[model samples]
Target: MGGKHSVLGNSTLNQSPTIENIQAAYKEGDTSRAQELIKISCGENNRLRLEKHQLLSVAAGNGDLEAVQYLLKEGRVDLPREPTDENPAVVAAYYGHEDVVKELLDSLPGTNWIGLRRLQELDVSDNRLTEVPACFLHCFKSLRSFNVSRNKLKVFPDPWACPLVASLIEFPGFLSECLEVLFLNDNQLEAVPQSVCCLKSLNELYLSHNPGIRELPPELGQLSNLWQLDIEELNIGNIPAEVRKEGPSAVLAFLRAHLRKAEKCKLLKMIIVGPPRQGKSALLEALQTGKVPQMMQNETSIRTTKWELEKPSGVKDKMDSVEFNVWVIGGPASMSTVNQCFFTDKALYVVIWNLALGEEAVANLQSWLLNIEARAPNAAVVVVGTHLDLIDSKFRTERIATLRAYVLSVCRSPSGTRATGYPDITCKHLHEVSCKTLEGFDGLRRLLFQVSCNIKDMSNAATSQKLVGRLIPKSYLLLQAAVLAERLRRDLEDEVQYLTDLQLEQIIEQNPDSDIKDYEDLQTD
Candidate 1:
């Protein structure tokens, strides 16, 4: 374990990176061919598993479902390959290759594989799994960790109900009781089955897409061991006061209002601002959706028919690759509101709106910025100029140039990287169609999600620094808080620490501050 090299039979060999082969495949542009060569090489018995893994890397990058299938289906492919940093089955499932996964599993039984015992950390989210196979149920019993979110399932399998004597060649046995992390999100479940709740050992329960499961059985709360309980897409606008009073304010807020939280119990601040009629409401709708939020526009007016986006956990696991969330904010008139809301125990996010140019917008924005440093002094500000369709071409070009020049001069990384880290300068994205046309809207949504993630990163960095000064143990809470914070603030390296500390104190003082005590206890845990 101390040495870089490993013994492969009687010979000693230097360990080589599998990425080299993957890079070669990428350069060759024949991902399928690369996969074939990788399989043949790996089959050498003395071959490096890392090389085969590299082929998987290439396949995932190219989005080659066939190449991916080959790797997963390979009889020699290590199904439980040392659960290194990435779980192979989870990775395969995450990338949307259910057929290949099933084939791989089916082949396992033929070889008297007593089943994968080390598959506890497996997560098959956002895949194309239509039905829960018996093999999968058996897989989960062995899986201490599993995520089956964002797939096309109508009902969850009763793993416990699985016949104990079911033939391994057909239906695998019910998943064993060690199941811990279960993500059954974005599915078509209308009822919360008694069996699911009976899994008293379950910890994190993500029931985001069961919108029709209108009420949670108080019995669910009986699972006292549960830590994270996500039920975001239930479409219930207001939470009962009884639910709010049951737990700490931060946890209750997550359950009710869908407000972002820091993993380290630090403050979160965000600002949303955008121009008039630029699909801001549409953006909000998408952010609040369970799956990839579908966009709808009026045939006549530029107004959004519906708004208010609630971000649910585990929705992205249903997607093929990286997925994003949309955010919509108001124009200059709402700057005061945005600034005020930015002062919370959450990370800060700023959405800059592009006004059609005539409405007292420029003056209002300048005045708002003058006070932003004073009010929410620690927050990260992102300038998003929306409504490119309505702006004049000449004006758009000039504005982009000006914004690009400003960011490059100020926000450039120490390594002399471009402000956007791209060949281009300004981060501004342009779209032509009105929300009525729904044109270029998907691109816009993707762009906003990208920005949101950046902001979130920044927020997390700030929280991480503060954690070093806190008494809390750096557990998953710190990691999750850091993740949530990062999603709100992309880079906290630029944040003013002293200001964050001062603002956090003020935010706590604004309320009865009972949540502060609860969080303090959580930190001790």
Candidate 2:
């Protein structure tokens, strides 16, 4: 036997051991040697030179389970009060030793274990953890801050596996009651689970940098306490552009607005019909950009001109705004035959008549309305009297009254035998507009918005009837052949090129088929 050595100085003798020898023994997995050294260090009346926390941390970090247990049980060493730079559990996790990590967590006091506990924050980030350990729920009921970022997690922690959450669902507060901050960024999560909504106290959530997550559950809106939500670098198209430009408040507003019935807001088709040179195109321009066209042309339009107004003003109370497809039919009464083709039960008819021609306004309005009713019965009509600036102040009142009375009488009258062709017509609104002065345009715009919002689900019967009525048997056969040719081009696997309009016309001329000649006039260059 050798003489005893001082606890503070290096061990020169064989009887006393130093902290370096204990660390070396632990790293070598020599539990017996480590235990023998610990016993000599804690010998009766012996001054303690090394801390137990330091010895246990080295044992746990080396993945020596037996050494860790021997030091904790026989050495009478307490668990680390708080995590430090050399935290044993963090080091074990960093080494990918699942058993050592579990053992370190298992040594912590249970929920009922009485003491001055201080284990609240756990940072197992930058590890090879595929999933969070379920034992965390049982051992660390007081855990408030957790960071599992930069891991291989495909989904969130399953709450069903947690015994505390299963047993406390009926209570006001459940598992993770004290959890305030959670970082699950840079993982392979596809969708957020609804269970995260249970974390009522979670204040800040970091879910950005995940490309697989395409859609967020609508239930995320239930997290009322969440203020800082980071969803950057995702492919979520449902979110409006405003959210990315303005921030989280816009996202909240968008979510709240979409929580309604699907049929409440829909696109509306509006047909603007009347005699030519009644400012129909000018009215559309004013409604679109609020700027009237400087030069007015009186030329008849050969084809229908289309304008679309998305999210127009005057109707914002609904969950989503309505889109108006305004089709203005131009040309004289001869062109009105094409108007029947576009008629639909859900359409709103805006009849524009020149108010400058006082008495003639009655005849003009009646002709357009009757033409529209013949095709689209049951259609909602808005009678707009344009060119009011040209009317004299002396006869303005009389002219307006006469026009209103005549239009109402025609709309109210029964079609009799002709009624079988279309639905009953009704005038929903009557207003005078001035394209040059922009006097009554505001009221007309508001009326169009209100009427379009109410109309819904118009039938397609009128469209089918018009198509069938216009084409003969020979002409119809050519149309079907053209349609089949178009479909073939679309469905063909080969990158086959089709002939242009001029080419097709040239081919038809060289062949000279009677059926093709019947539809030749209908073809456009």
Best by TM-score: 2
Per-residue lDDT tens digits for candidate 1, residues 1-525, read 111112121122232544455546656786656666666665677766765654554454345666666676762555553433243443444444445445545545454234355556765565566556544445444666767677776654554332334222122324325666778788776655445555557777887877767765433544545667777766534445434333332233333222222222322223444444444455445333423336554422112222222223433422222222222334445454653443332233344445454334434444444344445444455444444557566687676565444444443455656333222223453222234334444554555444333333223331222211122223334444544564456445665333355554444454452254434433322
Cα deviation of 7, candidate 1, in Å: 24
**Candidate 2: 10-residue stretch with minimal lDDT:** 462-471
Candidate 1 weakest ten by summed lDDT: 1-10
Whole-model lDDT values for every prediction = 0.46, 0.60
| Residue pairs that clash (backbone atoms under 3 angstroms), model 2 | 346-458, 377-423, 378-423
**Model 2 Cα lDDT, one tens digit per residue, 1-525:** 111122212453122335678766866768678767756665644544245655566566566677677766777666653544455665555544557767776677753322213456667676666776543434455667767777777754554222333234322143437768878788877765445656778877778877888876554554556777788887877675634454654454344334311112244567887788888888877777777777766655433444444444656634244466567777766767765676655577887888877667767666666667677666777888888889887988887787776766665644423233333434447888788888887777677766665553345331221110121333334544665575577668564456677855654554344344542334520
